[model samples]
Target: MRIVDTHLHLIYPDRFSYPWLATKPRLNWQPWTHEAYFAEAVPLGIETALHMEVDVAEADIMGETEFVLGLPRIAGAIAACRPEHMNFVDQIEQLSEHAHVKGVRRILHESPDDLSQSDLFIENIRHLPDYDLSFDLCLRDDQLYLGVALAQRAPDVTFILDHCGNPIPNGSGLDPWRASITEIAHNPNVVGKISGLVNHCDPGWTAETLRPYVEHMIEAFGWDRVLWGSDHPVATVTGGTLTDWVKATREIVSGASPDEQARLFHRNAERIYKI
Candidate 1:
C-alpha cells in the first residue's frame, strides 16, 4: 500500500538556526534533505511526505515552509508557530496564504506544562479557524489533559495529537496517560497521530511491546481519525531506523482491512491537510 508520512522534519543548517539543537550534539550537525529522505523512503512505498517543523529559529519559520514546498516529492508542511507570542495571529494570517502550508505546530512537549494552558495560547488558537489551519499538539503523556482543555477551548479548530500522546511503553498499560488519551479522543475536533512511540519504548522493543499502545489509540480514535507519521531523526534516538519504524507500524496494523489502512497511512492526511 502507498503511504504519506505526515510528520517528517527537514533540517538545513545554513538557512536556519535551530536553538533547541544547541544542547543535543547529535542532531546539530546534519542536513536532512529531500533527496536523502526519498533515497530511503521511496522504495518502502512512501510516495509523499509533509515536513514537520524542526523548531528552527523563530525568524526562519516561514523560510522552512518555503524550502520544503520547493522540493519535488514533498506534499506539504506543518510549520512552527509561537502562539504564546503576541504576533501569532499575524503569523497565521501570513502563513495561510501559502498553498502548501498545511498546518502549524508549537512543540509543547518541550515547554512547561502550563505554557499551553495560558489564556493567550488558547485565545490565539481560537483564530485558527479563520484561516482554516489545524494545530499539531505535541505534548508528553502527562500533559494529555492540557490537550483536552485546549481542544475544549477551540471547538471550531481541528487538532492533531502527535505521537499517540508520547506514551511510555516500558510502563504498565494505560496509567494516567491512557485515561487522558481516552478523554481527549472523545472530542470530535481531535485526531491522533500514531508516531513517536518508538522513542518511549525500550531500545530493543519488538512489535508485541508496541502493540497495546498502538491498539489502544486505534480503539479510542478509530481508523478514520488516526494518521501516521515517521517522526524521523527523533526515532533514530531509539535505535530504530525510519524503515524499521514503518515496518513495525505495518505489523501492528496488519489486521485492519485495506480501506482502514489507507485512511491511517494516506487518505486521512490528504483530507485533513487538504493535500
Candidate 2:
C-alpha cells in the first residue's frame, strides 16, 4: 500500500547547523539527502513525506524549511518553533505564509521538564490554531502526561505525539506507557505516531518485539488519528534501516482491513497534513 510519512527528517548540515549531530556520531556522516531517502522509501511504497524539523539552529529554521520543501516527494514540513518566547507570533505569522509548512515542533525530549510546562509555552502553542498549523510533541515516555496536559489546554490545535511517547519496546515501561497512551489519546485532538521504535529497541529488534506497542498505540488512538513515519537515520540506528521498519510495519498490520490500512498508511496523513 502507498504511504504518507508524517515524520521524515532530512539533515543538510552545510545548509543548516544541527547542533545535536555533534553528539550523535552514528548519524554524523554525510547529509541525508532526498535521493537517499526516496531510494528506499519509494520502493517500499512511501508515496510522500512531511519533513519534520531536525531542531536546527534558530537562525537556520526558515532556511531548513525552504530547503526540504523544495525537494522531490516532500509533501510539506513541520518547521521548528520556540513557543516559549514572546516573539513566537511574529515567527508564526512569517511561517503562515508558507503552505508547505504544515506544522511546528520544539524538541522537548532533551530539554528540562519545565520547558514545556511554562505558562508562556502553553499560551504560545495555543496560537497555532490561528495559522492552521498542528504541533508535533516530541517528549520522553515519562513526559507523556505533560504532553497530554498541553494538548488539553489547546483542544483546538492538533498534537502529533511522536515515537509512541518514546516507549522502550520489549522493556519494562509498557504498562506505564500504555496508561499514558490511553490518557493522551483521550484528547480528541491528539494523534499517535507508530514510528521510531527501532531507536528504543535492541540492535536486533524484530517485528514481534514491537508488535504489542504498535498494536496498543493503534488501539488507543484509533486508525483515524494514527499516522506512519520513517524517522529515518534515527530509525536506522540499532542496525535497522527504513526499509526494514516499513516491512516490519507492513507485517504487523497485515491482518488489518483495507480501509484501516488506508487510514494508517496514507489517508489519515493526507487529512491531517492537508497534503
Candidate 3:
C-alpha cells in the first residue's frame, strides 16, 4: 500500500539548536534531512510525508518550516508553537500564510500537566479552526485525559493524538492506555497516530508483540480516523531502521482487509492533515 507518513521529524543541527538532542545520542548521530529520509522511505512505499517539528528552539520555528518545505515530496509540516502564550495568534497568522504549514504542535508531554489547563492556552487553541489548522497532541500515556479535555474544549480544532498515546505493550500499562484511547476516540475531533510505538516498545519488539495495541487502536479509532507515522530517527532507536519499522508495521496488520491497510497507510493522513 502507498504510505503518507503523517509524523516525520527532520533535524538540522547546524541550522537549528536542538537542545534535547544532547541527551539523545542515538537520534543525535546526524541531522535527518529530507534527502536522508526520502532515500530510505521511497523504496519502502512512503510516497509523501508531513514534517513533524523537532521542537527546535523557539527562535527557529519558522526557519525550520521554511527549510523542510523547500525539500521535495514533503507534503506539509506540523510546526511547533507556544499556544500558552498570549501572542500565539501572531504566530498562527504568520504560519497560516505558508501553504505547507498544515498544523501546529506544542510538546506538552514534558511540561507540567497544568500547562494546557491555562485559560490562555485553551483560548488560543480555539482559534485554530479559523485558520483551518489542526493540532498534534504529543503526550505521555498519563497525559491523555488532558489531551481529551483539550479536544473537548476546542471542538473546532482538529486534534491528532500522536504515538497511540504512547502505549507500552510489553508492560501493565496497556489497561490504562486502552481506557484513555477509548475516551479519546469518542471525540470526533481527535485522530490517532499509529506510530512512535516502536520507540516506546521493547527493543526486540515483534509484530505480534505490537498486535494488541495496534489492533485496539484501529478498532477504537476505526480505520478512517487512524493515521500512520514513522517517528523516523526516534523509531530507529528501537526498530533499527525506518524500513524495519515499516516492515514490522506492515506485518502487524498483515491480516487486515486491503481497505483497512489503505486507510492506515495513507488515506486517513490525507484527510486529517490535508497533505
Candidate 4:
C-alpha cells in the first residue's frame, strides 16, 4: 500500500537558525534532506511526504516553507507559527499565499500549558479558517483539555491532533489520556494523527505495548478522521527507526479493511491538508 507521511521534518542548518538546537544537542548535527529521506522511504511504499516545521529560528520559518515547497517529492509543508507573537497575523497572511503551505504548527507541548489559553493566541488560531489552513495541535497528554478548548473555540477551523495526543504508554494506558482523547475526538472539527507512539513506549516495547493506544484512537475518531505521520528522527530516540515505526503501524492496522487503512495512511491527509 502507498503512504503519505503527514509529519516529516526537514532540517536546514545553514539556511535556518534552530535556537532550540543548542538544547537538543542530538538534532543539531546535520540537515535531514529530501534525497536521504526518499532513499529510505520510496522502497517502503511512501509515495509522498509533507515537510513539518523544525521549530527553526523565527526569522527562518517562511524561508523553511519556501525551501520545502521547492523540493520534488514534497507534497506540501506545515510551517512553524508563533501565535503568541504580535506578528502572527502577518505571518499567517504571508503563509496563506504560499500554494504548497498546507498547514501550520506551534509546538505547544514544550511550552507552558497556559500558552494556548491566552486570548491573543486563540484569536490568531481563529483566523486560520479565513485562509483555509489547518492547525496541527501538538500538546502533551496532560494538556489535552486545553487542546479541546482550542478546538471548541474555533469550530469552523480544522484541527489535526498530532501523535495520538502524545499518550505515554509507559505510564500506563486508558487513564486521563484516554478520557481526554475521547472528549477531544467528539469535536467534529478535530481529527487525530496515529503517529509518534513509538516514542511514548518503553525502549523495548513490542507491537502489543503500542496496540491499545492506537486502537483506542481509531475507536474514538474512527479511521476516516485519522491520519498517519512518521514523526521520524524523533522516533530514533525510542530505538525505532522510521522504517521500524511504519512497519509497526502497518502491522497494527492489518486487520482493518482496505478502505480503513487507506483513510488512515493516505486519504484523510490528502483531504485535510488539501494536498
* Best of the two (1, 4) by lDDT: 1
Per-residue alpha-carbon lDDT of candidate 4 for residues 220-239, written as tens digits (9 for 90 to 100):
99988999999876677777
lDDT of 1 at 240: 76
Give the count of colliding residue pairs in each prediction.
0, 0, 0, 0
**Residues 236-263 of candidate 2: C-alpha lDDT, one tens digit per residue:** 8789999889999999999999999999
Query: Regarding lDDT, does 2 or 4 come out ahead?
Result: 2
TM-score of each: 0.96, 0.98, 0.97, 0.96
Q: Who is ahead in TM-score, 1 or 3?
A: 3
Error of 1 at 77 (Å): 0.8
RMSD of each: 1.3, 0.9, 1.1, 1.3
**lDDT for each residue of candidate 3 in 1-275, tens digit (9 for 90 to 100):** 99999888988898999988989988898878888889989999999999999999999999998888888998999999999888999999999999979999999889999999888999999999999899999999988989989988888899999999988766655798998899999999999999988777777877777788889998899998999999987888864788878998999898989999999998888887776
Off by over 4 Å in 1: 171-173
Off by over 4 Å in 3: none
What is the RMSD, in Å, between candidate 1 and the native fold over all Cα? 1.3
